[model samples]
Target: MLEPAEASPGTQAEQASFQGIRRICGFIAENFREDIDCVDIAVSADIHPKYAMSVFKRSTGMSLGEYVSLMRVSYAQALLMRDDASILQVAMDSGFGSVSAFNKCFRKKAGMTPSEFKREHRAAPPPLHA
Candidate 1:
């Protein structure tokens, strides 16, 4: 499946514009672990903060904070599903500053607490075939 920009446009300007946003998105994905703000992200993306926020929101349909939280919650959810990493480990590794924040976001996004998610989603051992 193609992204909207990839599927709908082939113009050079469109491609360039898309690339700029992609660069920003990539930076966010890579560095959301650290404390990152819109200004820092904008600097990494080589654009002004206000413009970056506007562009990002327009392109992605969410504010930068929302996107970062979404990304963190998503990564944390994946770790939780594995059921090996501790909740605190998942929180830190997934870029949350604290367990409380991670839990709040996880519940908002997944409709369950992190521990509950892990417990419920943990895969059962394969049936022991004789």
Candidate 2:
């Protein structure tokens, strides 16, 4: 019979860290449409806020706020494509407090303002039947 190799201490630590990161990500995904902060994320993941910030940064190379902003902007992009909603409405729906913030973050990550992105990427309408 083949014996299973025991995990080393480093591997075990890495596993724990991975689990923590997963929990943090889950919380963020579930609540990204709300006004969530590091303290909220930490509480959901059962870690100290400061520790959560460090772990998130170490694993994702960005702060919690940055991740949240990314999620919001990405969502806003989809909304802009499919909805005729105004930019302010899309920003609010995507969890941004204001259109300026939405435009700034969207431009930072997507290389264009929300309006520009919508103009460039909105889907064309289907042809009418004869």
39 Cα displacement, candidate 1 (Å): 1.2
Instruction: For candidate 2, list the clashing residue pairs, or say none.
Output: none
lDDT of each: 0.85, 0.89
Worst 10 residues of 1 by lDDT: 4-13
lDDT of 1 by residue, 1-130 (tens): 6765566545655666677789889999999888899999889878889988987888889999988888888888788778477999999998988999988988998899999989988867779889
10 residues in a row with least lDDT, candidate 2: 1-10
TM-score of every candidate relative to the true structure: 0.83, 0.89
Candidate 2 per-residue C-alpha lDDT over 1-130 given as tens digits, one digit per residue, 9 for 90 to 100 = 3222577777777777788889999998889989899999999888899999998899999999999999998899999997576899899999998888888999999999999998988888889999
Candidate 1, position 6, lDDT? 66
Which one is best on TM-score?
A: 2
